[model samples]
Target chain A: MRILPRTAESGSYAALAGLAPKRRPSLTPYYFILPYLVFFVLFRLGPSLAGLGIAFTNWQAVGTPRFVGFANFEAMARDPRLGDAFQNTVFFVLLTVPTLIVLSLALALFLNQPRRGRAVGRVVVFMPYVIMSTVVGVLWTWILDKDFGLLNVYLNFFGIANVPWLVSESTAMYGIILTTVWWTVGYDMVLFLAGLQDIPHELYEAARIDGARAWGVFRFVTLPLLAPTTFLVLMLTIINSFQVFDQVYVMTSGGPGTATLTLVQYIYTTSFQFQKFGYGSAVALILFGILVIVAFFQIRGYRRGLKGVE
Target chain B: MSRTISRAAWYVLLAVVVALVLAPALWMLSTSIKPEREIITTQIRWIPQNFTVEHFQAIVQNYPMMQWLFNSLFTATAATLLVLVLDSMAGYAFARMEFRGRGLLFMIVLSMLFVPIQITVVPLFILFSRLGLTDTYWALILPVGANVTGVFLMRQFFLSIPGELEEAARVDGASAFRVFWSVVLPLARPALTAVAIITFLSTWNSFFWPLIVTRSDSVRTLPVGIAQFLSLRAGMVQGQMSIGQSMAGAVFAALPPIIIFVILQRYFIEGISRTGIKG
Candidate 1:
């Protein structure tokens, strides 16, 4: 809840009074910034601009690019694969964002209790996130294997039949989603725990003194105060889900029949694998557009919720 | 009595949660050590009947596992060091100095956060290829210097700290560079450590760019190498790497970071929580 204090004015004042020895109109600040600026321009800013321009061209790996305005974007309208990729990506986001929010919130609330051994639980839960994504993908594939997978073996104990997880078109996305949730829910829980800890304990004490029950305290006191963190977690999860690629690439290669084909996977295959740079860039731009629109709505909703709270 | 019951229930819930989270990792480790015959069996075996190091030995002998590991370590460390130096200086300037167009410049840098890296990859690839820098460490190390998060976090941290020490050093006629070097950099350790850990972790786990740029095993990092060769699909198609060996490769790639996380558990949690709260 701490706000960053404005220091620029105070810094100038110190220099004016000669309390700081820096002379006015000095170029030292520029000197400090220039080194990072060089790399930022070449690697980050310049490439972003170039990518935008390339989206309009008929660029390929071996040919001189010719300007072909809006052709690639139009191609997307007829490309069934791109359509499938878009739909699959949205479905992925829908499946993941809400589930991750609720599950991680539950875990945070459970672990935030003033009980013994909670730290161990927190550590254990966050352990998987430390593993590399590709390793996670490989490990989960074996665990979700049909005949001898650990998941099916345990399910049989509960009288459940074996579920063809990654090998079946109907169940492949679900398998990746399960792996993703397991790998990342702990991260969101950690964020939510930080938020919970930020709430003043006095509010809870007051709620209990007013004869509020546990559910009442949580609903009334906890939820309202936790809005900012919830908004942040939601945004982070949504953005990450929209860009889901690593596990899909490693686990199924968007396969069994394009069931797990995501936008980034499509982009990777088109540009890198097939050397259609322009089309890939166009798809990547569309992805950027989707992220921007989602972020816009999320921020607007958050502002409206804040106004309602006020 | 109800309090005691609730406490016992908490323990049970904790146990279940822990088991669910740890099972896959434990399964990976178990599979890595199990012999091929036991790994292929249908019966559920948490403990291997016969523990073997043959899979690990085979992967090491056949694949460039150690080279991939070294590549990951070298690039991630170089990137982290680069980000720390560059971000701290730029962060110091942004926090404490007043200059023309400073606010606008800072805004431009911050705007990159919304611009995902996917947009830049195509052009970045072309640029690197033109420079003939693909399949080199510079291809991996240089782009990381342009990261936005480290700069933002560093600037926030610098703003939060009181500027009295820097001022005192400056009033003693220390130059701007001297004040920053001796007076400010030491105080920025916590922020530096957080930025370093985040950058290192991401770079080490980075798959996409390395996959694009590197053609051979000489420059492929651990994640890319694992995804290309050790994945289940890869194993299935190539018919070379067994499940046990695949698991061994996975465990080989995973253990260092996991072990580091356990050792620096506090810093890892604190650093991650810091990013969330501050962002």
Candidate 2:
């Protein structure tokens, strides 16, 4: 629990670097951060680079790195599985992000009310978010069971047939989407709830004084203020939605003929399950590129919105 | 009148949302308690008619659940502790210190957050396989030790504090580490707690890393074990198991984060709120 406060008297950063005390006692910060960095480079950056290397070479995990440049990427271009994975991953992001944002904002509104049970409700809803994805998959499997699940059993009175929630390709991704929404909405709700609390009461009163209706206040006032949080959550949700490996692995295994096969899942299969390091690495790098581009567009949109505000 | 109309609509919407969210969880709980006959029944009942705890009793009595619980709890705790110490130190340096390459270094680490956790899986496997670290707790704890969020978080939090406190301490001839340990770390409680809660929860909930690393039930954590339980083709338990056992596992896995949040709900919100917005 040591902290090193480098005493830099000069205002300039360069001056601080030269003028600060030589003995940085918490130089331990470097060491403190060392373990993580070592692992990061080794596990994260190393493999990612190795993955890049492997992509260029026909390197399986067990084999020599014989160069077969551009072949893996070319194969990816032709691979129908890669194409399906891309579509499904995009579909997953599309389905989950909007629903998550909507549900989170709605719940945040509910929990924002200064009511007796509001706190309790907030904690309860947030409970699911904290659970492991593995546990979530199992719980949903039982709950969404076609013959034995609560969903179809409840639907029995309406004379609806039992839906093959995770079995059929058409419905399979939907099941994953629904499960994802339930699991992650609470996290965003908490964020939005925090954002809502930050909005001053004076704005609402001011809107009312201007003869603004509830919807008017929400549209003009609340929505504008919540944009920052919405932006952040939306960006995170898109990233997280694309990175759906654990649930797919646990629940569907990208199954029922590749309906739920996300790009990351494909990467997983190639790397670990199929043992094609080069192929997996190339797919991973592409997925990484896609995510980076998506992140850029989102931030661009956010910046554009911010510019409008300014 | 408008208030009344909107309020009614709000209630209906909230009701539907709550039902949609709670139905799966409630069903898991119900199925957990119901007998195999009741579970497989065509009729839907919210309350289990059989209401048996046999599955729970079996999970506890028949399985090595206690070990799994201990393993998950201890590993998560250890990881959180290490992260707090190291992350805070690095965070303080990145925020307060006039270190070389600090901004660029911080940017690199921050960008790495988007590196899909899956990207690291292979090299880690290769690395651990070489290190002979497989099946050990160190394997589970080390790779995830350096959390970019924690470092970024600590740095931001330190910057927010009035610098005069550190100035005052340093004037009194306090060393940097001493200043951070005694004066700064105590003040960063809210931020530290935020990092700790998320860290512990994620660590506890981690399945993929541990699944790849640990060999058997002896070293495996709760989530992986439960996943194995579901995927088990062994001894095809025809009517031998019930939903209760899985629910109990879910309850075990889910309850800790809920309780931790209950204990520190304010800090929990503060943590998430700060994560993205802060530069």
Candidate 3:
């Protein structure tokens, strides 16, 4: 874990310069990594660092950002819109993550078994993941279209009344969640399937021979083995749910009156639509901070679970 | 026996799950082929009564679907190739090279992965505007020339490459680059292919950046074009007929990713599965 290379290695690199020894490996790495490094710095690093500065300024997208140290953050502390975005974002994370986790796990477990037509089922389940969020938004808009939506149509077929799916604030978030779950669960399922594959069959057989019930085997063998995949999926689901912008932008446009305006969509609208770059950076910074916290916990949880380390 | 009933229940439950998953996709296809009137009709039909290829034909007739296809192909392929070559070299250097600040530089490089594409959008737009590179290929390609995921993957791959082979090459008087090309590159095919497929798909499926960067249809790629066409309908089914025509367009949009995924499935899954290392 030494940060720098040994002096002996450094001298060797110098001596082996002309000979171009692969072991000494030249300054070639710097030359090689330059393209990606340059772009990464220019695009990802530059904007992020600039945005960090903007969080403390009064940038308005068109002019010089006057330094207003912590004013944006202070404004964000009392901003009603940010509060709503945060509330809605938290609700979305809470709502979508659990549903996606349970449903995807159930689907994955179902497909994990050697059943008939499992391959067809898996591929079919995975199809929605391939479509664009815009398309998913559009398709679901029609399907949940209050007047002509297939759901309302089906409900009527069963003697139910017409329900405004996306028009109502209460139902709108549900519509987004439903669309997201159906469209996304397959990806988590695929990850789970890979995890399920890694679980040795003989372990199940051994448990079966020892007179363990199906539930017992799943609890003891399957769950423990699949925890890593589940953890990864949970991590993804939480990140995705928090950063839920596309569906909001596409489906409801963050309405029926700001019911589904997620943190990301809010940040997006703040900068682009409202052109409040400084406040937007504050929002972005808050999101960044929240993600960092979530990531820290997730990493800690993963390591503690995997290595039993504190 | 209860076994028969249980089996039937499992099948039925799975049937429902499959239906839920495929319904939107099938709906997309169904709408794409449906004739104009049928789409607007109050009638709710799972399968279209009258299907036509009009939408596909319309795209072919009025729009530069072919040009869009070519742009997507050219950009994705070129970007994938560039990422592969550049990423692999950098990966090898970082993993194997004994140099100053190598580890620190790599940590910095990889840290860029945490910065979501959205954070970069506004500044990049400004930067590209200043460079007057907007609407051009550089606007599209240059910014993504070196992806962090590709570098991370390639570096991991290089670490796994046997140090003895590298030492053997040096012992045999082979140049560093020579050993990399001859010994390292060939052996890193599986990793390279994984990197290639993932890179290709990401580039192909890239949306916000391409939409922001490209000014007109001549440069606009499939995702943006499809978004434009879809959004023109403005989240409505105005131009759509019988769901079949729109379905056809949806199918067309999703086809390349499917074909590529199927062709390079092993690499595709591996690449995706590994790309979540931070997660």
lDDT of 1 at A212: 100
TM-score of chain A by itself in each prediction: 0.94, 0.89, 0.90
Which candidate gets the maximum lDDT versus the true structure? 1
Minimum summed lDDT over a 10-residue window in model 2 chain B is located at B231-240
True-structure Cα RMSD, model 2: 3.6
Q: What's each prediction's TM-score?
A: 0.96, 0.91, 0.88
Between prediction 1 and prediction 2, the one with superior DockQ is 1
DockQ of every predicted complex? 0.59, 0.45, 0.40
Task: Give me the runs in candidate 3 sitting further than 4 Å from their true place.
Answer: A1-25, A307-310, B1-13, B59-67, B232-248, B262-267, B276-279
TM-score of 2: 0.91
Tens-place lDDT per residue, model 1, B32-60, is 99999998887878899888999999999
lDDT order of candidates, best first? 1, 2, 3
Model 3: lDDT equals: 0.74
Best model per TM-score: 1
Candidate 1 global TM-score: 0.96
Which segments of candidate 1 are over 4 A away from where they belong? Answer: A1-24, B234-237
Candidate 2 residue lDDT tens string, A172-209: 88888888888988899888887787789999999999
| Backbone clashes, candidate 2 | 7
Question: How many clashes show up in model 3?
Answer: 18
Error of 2 at B213 (Å): 2.0
